[model samples]
Target: MRYLVHYVEDVTERVHAEAERARLVAALAAERGQLRAALLQAMTPMALLVGPEHRLELVNDAYKRVSGGRDVTGLTYREAFPELEGQPFFDIQDRVYATGEPWAATAVPVRYDRLGAGLEDAYFDLRYEPVRDAEGRVFALLSYGVDVTEQTRAHLAAERERQRLAAVLEHLPVGVTFAEAPAGRHSVSNPAAVAIWGVVPASPEVAAYSRDFVGFRPGPGAPGSPEEAARRIASHEWPLARALAQGEVVQDELVEIERPDGARRLVSLSAAPVRDADGRVDGALVTSVDVTERERLLAESEAARARVTAVLESIGDAFYAVDAEFRFTYVNRRAEALWQRCREDLIGRHYWSEFPAAVGSESYRMHHQVMSERRPVHYETISPLTDLWIDVSIYPEAGGGLACYFRDITARKTAEAAREAAVARAEGARAEAEQANRGKSEFLAVMSHELRTPLNAIGGYAELIELGIHGPVTEAQRTALARIQQSQRHLLGLIAGVLDYSRVEAGAVTYRLADVPVGEAVAEAEALVAPQLRAKGLGYAWSGAPPELHMRADREKLQQILLNLLGNAVKFTRPRDGVPGRIEVACTVDEERVHLHVRDTGVGIAPEQLERIFEPFVQADQRLTRAQEGVGLGLAISRDLARGMGGDLTAASVPGVGSTFSLTLPRA
Candidate 1:
């Protein structure tokens, strides 16, 4: 029974050992399958079981693709890729196999003949490793590689581009500077940048480089002094340092710096962040420009503008300037006053808009004419706004503009219009006076002719009865007849005077223009007036008469004028206060005229009545009961007849003293 039990235990132990062996075998097969499959289908190129003789024992699909479909399995390395026989790749692999050491190659080059394509070059990251048995004795070499052709070419291209950019930054005309981020290293600069910064174009760590930058000083009114400015640059407190440290972008920051020659230069600077591939700020690129000349020119232009403004403001006339479009550019104080607005309201405003009613007015037309013709124009126009007349002068300026100077002339224009109205009225009154004189002369002519003939017949009958061809009259009858005759003669004389006055006033009197001796004319006038003078018992005198004095006049008109004036003097005397009135006749001759004067010493004309005495139908004593016997036509007719003979009659008188009537005629 013990033996049966032992047999069963042994059988159980054998079955268990067999089961464990089978499980071990299955695991080994699975591991080998996984290894083979991983090699054959790997994206990376792989070769297995390569001998020390440099022969390829196994190759994967990736290796086949890298070899351009060339069958390289079971072939020696030299046979598979003959073009690579003299290269360092095989030597590197042989060294790995002989020493049983693994080797790595980065970006190694290899060339091989393709299956259907031509020979081509490729690059790879390769690994050569020795495969050893269980006793650690190397039997075969394993080679694996990554196809890094695109990456290798990309690295080479990036290196070339970096070199080219460095050269460009070094030679660019504008100042260029580079600063490394977080390091505060302003290590790169071109020649222009060094000149702008007044610093050495070297590494930032060098003391001289930082010291050279210390010479930079802030411009006037800046935030810092020279020492502070240098500290800002060195301590990364400036815009360039801020851009690199904080990844900030700064543009067109104006600053002034002291140059090497002890002169200040104005600079405009711009800075931007330079980033790495990981989007981290790596450095900053800064550019600068010198703007000193530009600033100086701007300041000069401002000064010149102020000078011109001062001149314009000081002018007297109302002055304004406008562009070609009639938009006001400048307006002075006087111009603002004339426009009744402020200068700020007028400047940059259209002319027509400021004065809307002047759009088609004469002033506007003249301005446009001057603009078109490129000349100057002067004109006067009435402003509808103020109702004032304006005298304006417009001049064309240099730059398609206009300058206008103007003033108000309303007062002068008003005075001229008033004078013209007064002259017109005077002309109208003179015409009316002429018409009235014509009517008076016509009435006088009819009365003189109608009454003179009847009065003359009565005088002739009275004379015949006084002669008495019918015989015998008593003294009383004779006396009555004489009185009747006297009345008849007086009526006849009055009629004749009316007839003479009518002819003279009507301008119908015939004139014989002959040279009449002045003394002879006075003698004839005295004889005609002597009867009246003696009857009134008036004293008479004559002096100042030159025998050689002659007058160009009508002889009869001259005698008639003198007779009327002397008779008026005799009739007015009336022996006042028992003093006989005196009459004087005199003549004065000048180069151009002859004057005949008749002076009366009794009942002189009043000062106010002298001018009225020469007017028709005017009398010295204007009452009906006055002592004067005749109508007041005598003096008027005398003056008219004197004027018709190219002469004038003027009278001067003082009341209660004397009167003088002078007849002036043009000398022959």
Candidate 2:
């Protein structure tokens, strides 16, 4: 066997290997201890041997100085040191015998009693192993230790601080997660990270977001996903990308992360390189902030740019918009065609000054209308050269000069003269007589026929359903027939309202003065509608309705109005998967008037035509005159009926979201 004898290099691994030779106790053939000693003597750490039974067999002299020069030879360890037994001193020897393998045991708190540790300032990393003779027979076990007390104490302090730091991470206001390098396993996470994970917990770990190197989800996809983003990163030779692969320190940088919430969060990630004592690369340290709200505000500012572009494209007439000098500023599709110029050519040229001959007479009136009125003004004049009849209007622009809208009306004037001559010749006397009485007589006959037909059917069905003369009705068909009967009654009320509007117009409508139970009528109407509301996923609730609320009114007419309004609210309200959409009916009283309001988050009315919505057969949506498959007479008749009962109906709306129709009546 060769003796190594001198320390020359980085000694940590060499010392550990030499220590292992003592563990091959049962497996030793011959000269194992001599061979192990030779191997250990060359380690960069100073080597030594204590006797198998606990006396110092030899020292490398480095051990003597560190151990403070105590002559340990031939002395029994447990006798000199009674504390060695409780510290598993025997197990360390026997572990070598059984497995014949070395196991590390350090920081057992051995005092350097003889080493001038008078101030209590030293510790060691001690090991025990079997020693073999030259003939490969077990002769003794060797024990050794190195002074590692300072390193051990520092490790313990660092562990304590690491645990405290992990606890503080749990209270982090923003999400924090760590991904280990190489494997990219989830090593640590804060409470905020857990919550954000729950929001879209498709996968348990954020490893899917890691780059080819050791980096977590603080990555962004600019023109794409991870693969495409990495390609861009490689093309740009990003420093973070290089550091993550090699475990180098990387400065903080912004990245894009697409969250499962379908939002883009801009994040800044910073990683610092971690290394072993030998300075070999180990891994990195990575940190994400949500910047979606800021980006959304920026996007909204861009929308205003789109609105400006839309205004420039919408003008349809033979319009000319120009600057202070009458230089053409913008021309839409038709305006470009009329000026006989391409958009590229027309945009920068002078319009009025280009044809300076035409500006003095007819063009002056067009230009004056905009500057003086500061509003759109219209006039008819012939073009000087073309002699074409032009109806022109000029609107003053916010930034500058005039925008003129003019149309040829030469044929219209000639047609008007012919019509004037024709009107002068005849027909005024005969038309006035037919227009006054004929329309009224026809409306009364239609109303009488329509109301009487439904009244007869309603009366006949009431008689039959009551007597069971039509045979036994199925439960389903009986429910249907009941709805039909209810509808017929509602139809009859509409006819009565039509008659009421006529009476009001002629100042003949009258009221039967009496106190009626308003709640009883509202309850009856609710019961009739409650079945349909339940079938169609509509919610029905009543509030501020006293059990015996009294009012001076016609009972049948008030019930009809409540039924119509509430039914409309229910029918228009849409639902999804059997869940009711919002429709609320509420009433409030302040002693003067009982305000009944039906509001719905259903289809609403447009603003322009809300004023005349109460006129007979005049619906807010005309092309959809029967869009909902209903006679539009309901609201018109309801208004007249309310006025007849000394009440009023008014509506307010926001298109697409909802409408609220209110009925205010004096209380008895």
For each candidate, what TM-score against the reference? 0.42, 0.29
Alpha-carbon RMSD, each predicted model: 36.4, 26.6
Instruction: Please list the C-alpha lDDT of all candidates, in the order they appear.
Output: 0.80, 0.64
1-668: candidate 2 lDDT, tens digit per residue: 99889966888987787777655543573455675566446332233234445454554445545645655445555554454556565556666544545555667665445354543445567665666556855555555677777898898889989999887886776666554555433465566754443232235434554333233233433336677656755554343444545665655555555554556556554556556688754544444344445456667878975785576567555666777667787667665665556767767788755656577786776676577677777788887635778788787888767777776788998998899888865566557755664567458646866777869778678658745787877777777778877777766765665565555444455667566766776678888888878887676666758856677677777877788788777867786555567767787787767778888877788998778777765766777454454545667767877888888888998887778889877787
Under the 3 Å rule for N, CA and C atoms, how many clashes does model 2 have?
A: 4
**Residue-by-residue lDDT tens digits, candidate 1, 627-650:** 777767788888888888888999
Q: Which candidate is the best by TM-score?
A: 1
Off by more than 4 A, model 1? 1-437, 469-474, 509-512, 533-538, 574-581, 622-625
Mark the regions of model 2 whose C-alpha exceeds 4 Å error after superposition.
1-442, 445-447, 450-508, 546-549, 576-579, 624-627
Single out the weakest 10-residue window by summed lDDT for candidate 2. Answer: 42-51
